[model samples]
Target: MTFPSGGRVPEPYGQSSGANLADILERVLDKGLVIAGDIRINLLDIELLTIKLRLIVASVDKAKEMGIDWWETDPALSSRAHRDELARENAELRAHLAELERGRGQEDPSLERGRVSEEPS
Candidate 1:
């Protein structure tokens, strides 16, 4: 099946054939098992992923040209901005708790959504 993102939605478990099953099993069980290597799994609960490799390699000039500030703005990453954000978040949490204590029924703040836009292109 084709997903909305136009990526192939592979057959669900037990729907695909023997070759597909073999491929899946090999990929899961024999990862890093090439050239005299071996892979081990618990098969109890899901094997806790030991390490996740996330490689993002770009030429410095190209990255600078694109204004791609790697790790600086990502929330999951630990940076000074993240720490500052945590501090701000703590302050906001305190403010929100104070507001709740003061008993303002939390209806989400609404902005003007009356206007509709016409497609230009």
Candidate 2:
């Protein structure tokens, strides 16, 4: 541990650096990390295909801080989104039914009398 300068030498690749896997992961999640890459395939000097890939790794809080909360509004991922979607659909259906009823009433004067036309047994 002694050096020529009479000071302790820093350990090489040792725990003293405090760079363990857990520590690295915690830092990554706290600060967030983005990996971006592009792959291109060319034939006869012409670009045929290109693929762009982006990946981000972070904690939920960090992701929200970065304004990346698509999961919250995605119906497949969020119950609240699914409920909202259902409510919207229900409202649309109700509106359509009311419109149809109004159209039918205009065509049949008996419908405006509020009389239920009983069907034959």
Candidate 3:
């Protein structure tokens, strides 16, 4: 083939074009990327199964900037969340115990005295 300037063909799409895999990954992480899709299976025109997938790729700081800090409050991923969960459970148990004590006190007036018998002998 005759070409103007030196007779050289352009590289194919798969060939290196200066942008390597690392450079592409760096750009994706810096700007953040989201991939979302849904899959549905139908049987006889009736929906049988559905799967929705969502993925986000970004640095921790970028994720935080987007208000995606679920791991911070997830009990499985955070010790602070575990402590908060325990405190909430402890408070609930204490409240339940107090309610039971109040109910028991109102159920029996003679119990306040030394009499332990529930019925006359």
Candidate 4:
């Protein structure tokens, strides 16, 4: 199609001859962009619900290039070492909690009978 200026417009989309969709996508991935928004549900000026969302779209190489590869070592991502460390930390916390409860004279009777539950920590 032709514009009022007598210049031909690119078909399908407004992309000019100097730029293509692939170039746009490559730039976006190479230089990460964050799309963040907040949604709130308010009733009579009292917010009943608030949700915040943040999204980043990038290629794996780009993500790693930006030092954003947390999933590689995250416990939830099935990293055995991280999972073990988390398990140890959780056990320590539970033991600390049990000690505190005992100090307060609140002990589970089953614990005294060597019948502790199989629950973690």
lDDT of each: 0.61, 0.90, 0.88, 0.82
lDDT of 3 at 110: 60
Q: What is the lDDT of residue 62 in candidate 3?
A: 89
Candidate 1 residue lDDT tens string, 41-97: 656787754544444344445455557576667767757878888999999999999
| TM-score of structure candidate 3 | 0.71
Would you list the rank order by lDDT, best first? 2, 3, 4, 1
> How high is each candidate's TM-score?
0.32, 0.71, 0.71, 0.47
Q: Write the per-residue lDDT of candidate 4 for residues 1-121, one digit (tens) a residue.
A: 7889999865665646447777988898988888999999999999999999999998889899888887777777757868787899999999999999878565657675554455557
Q: Which lDDT tens digits does candidate 3 get at residues 1-121?
A: 4478778787778668557977998888889999999999999999999999999999888899999999999989999999999999999999999999989878756665646565467
RMSD of each: 26.1, 5.3, 6.4, 10.5
lDDT of 2 by residue, 20-120 (tens): 77899999999999999999999999999999999999999999999999999899999999999999999999999999998886776676444555544
lDDT of 1 at 36: 35
| Candidate 3: residue 118 lDDT (0-100) | 50
The clash count for each model shown is: 0, 0, 0, 0
Clashes by residue pair, model 2: none
Query: Is candidate 1 or 4 superior in TM-score?
Result: 4
